[model samples]
Target: MASGQVKSAAFVLLLLNLLLYFIVTVMAVWAVNHAIVRSRKTASVLTIPARIFPIYFPVGNMATGFLVIFSLIAGIVGMATSATGYLNVTDGKIQNLHAAAASSLVTLFLTFLAMGLACKEINIGWIDANLRTLEVLVIFVSATQLFCAGAIHARVSEVATILNIYGSGRV
Candidate 1:
């Protein structure tokens, strides 16, 4: 495929990723609103593991959302530079790909942790059915978005490296 088409594909994927993260963030906020904040204090010592680490789920979800936003922004900036013919294998533009990949990796880790915590909570019946469903959706979508971000980063990096080889590092 031509370089222009590749950048456009990345642009579309980035937009889809942005929308997915936005949805996940909204769902997470809704779940947080419904979840109990302090009622776990009076629970018996027999409480499940979910009771022991309730904050991680919500906080992780929020952090994933934030990281995804950064990745999305970085993706857009990278695309803009590529479109303007400013991309280089050994220049500041390469940093954008690295930043996006790093953000996505962190987001993926946090979302996975959140999903595990959500499962614990679900098993113990600590979460409402409706909110549990939404939270699960958020976790799942965020995971997919993070995966795409990683893929885009890899594609851009490979392309940049190949272009460098062809250009003999002169550009």
Candidate 2:
């Protein structure tokens, strides 16, 4: 397969992965909100403990795990595609590779930051709220990163077109 085709496939896979990530995030947020509502509505604090344990524990763990795994996968795929692009050595391809690598690195950093914030057990009054805010920030950053990745992929396709024309001896 041609380098262009490989790049395009990688981009498509990345987009699909991003879509899945988005879905997972939305579901997790909904689950968390639902749990919060239930926690608020229940009458007995003791019974509430039992109620929350059944719902919150599983959902929160799943959500955290999913985000961590998805972020890691995205970073790895982006790096692999970038490496492939670099190997291709075409001018247009290089740009795509650079963009992919940079985006991946940024994503990796962001994910780690999010994990750190979420995992910290220290709670000094407003700390829980602070952690929640950080989580929201991570979500926003991830969405932006997804958009940038899609744009980079589109640019790669355009570059491939130009390169093909140039290779074909067309002025």
Candidate 3:
């Protein structure tokens, strides 16, 4: 694709990822807080099994804890990736593109981890509506993030090819 087209695609993907990641972050935060408060409120009446769990989630299965934690980390990293991506795309600098690609790759990996946990949680069942929402969002984000990372990586390759062809940005 043309450089302009690549940049535009990257920009749009970054913006979309930013918005989705923000929502994920908000929902994950709420889920964590809700779980904590509920767990604390029921601490006095907890059963032996509940006590054994590191973090008790009232709704989902054991995978809930890992899923939520990974989701929160992915959300945060995804947001930061979006910011760096935006800057790199706008600046059109090869150096910044490298940074953006690295961050996006990290975010992609995190999203994949969260997605895997989410799938496990789903398979185990007993998840609530909010958790289902989070799962869906994480799944969706993982797909979009893959695309975003690919776009950045494509741009990086394009720049590299251009630099190799001409030995510099200037002809």
Candidate 4:
């Protein structure tokens, strides 16, 4: 019920969220490798939906991986700053918490969007090739969205802090 307790709870949740994010990322990478191996053996592309896209193009894997790493870093930084601010309960820290949380959330959102677009592209390629890439891409996109949702949930407390600061008639 106390603010300290709330902050402690938030910290625990954030750590758990981070753990899940890491797990999902690892799984996605594994899935991509598996799909590539299967495709190389069978020379087939897997199709899912017209909305989904294949990521067979050059540099696509690097781009997706970069987005994932960036999102992960942002999430970690945001959660760390938020936990510190909550634990310290000092003035002016709230703004830092807010900005960090917002930036992290935005990064996560962008990452999710990129994953989705990649999935869409992969799905399109599936129509022509029998590659299992579409399934892997879909799983990766789902994981990204789930991770982003967790980050957004973690940001809620920080966002409230920002709103309260502005509402209190203090700059």
TM, every model: 0.54, 0.38, 0.94, 0.43
> lDDT per residue, candidate 3, 1-171, as tens digits?
998888889999999999999999999999899888787666557787777778677667889988988899999989988987898878877888899999999899999999999999999998889999999999999999999999999999998899998787621
Better of 3 and 4 by lDDT: 3
Report the lDDT of model 1 for residue 147.
48
TM-score of 1: 0.54
Count of residue pairs whose backbone atoms collide, per candidate? 0, 0, 0, 16
Best by lDDT: 3
Local error of candidate 2 at residue 64 (angstroms): 6.6
Give the better candidate number (1 or 2) by lDDT: 1
| Model 4 bad stretches (over 4 Å) | 44-92, 107-171
- Tens digits of per-residue lDDT for model 4 on 1-171? 445554455455445545544554454455456546654433334345411344432223424443334434444443454344334333325455465456545545655554555565464443322123423433453454455445434455654665687764222
By TM-score, the best candidate is: 3
List all candidate RMSDs to the true structure. Answer: 7.8, 11.3, 1.6, 8.9
Candidate 1 residues lying further than 4 Å off, grouped into runs, are 1-9, 35-92, 168-171
Per-residue lDDT tens digits for candidate 1, residues 1-171, read: 554554555555555555655555565554445334623443334357645653433333323333333333333433333332222213335555565555555555555655555555555554445555645664565566554555556656666787688853422
Ranking of predictions according to lDDT: 3, 1, 2, 4
Which candidate, 1 or 4, has the higher TM-score?
1
Better of 1 and 4 by lDDT: 1
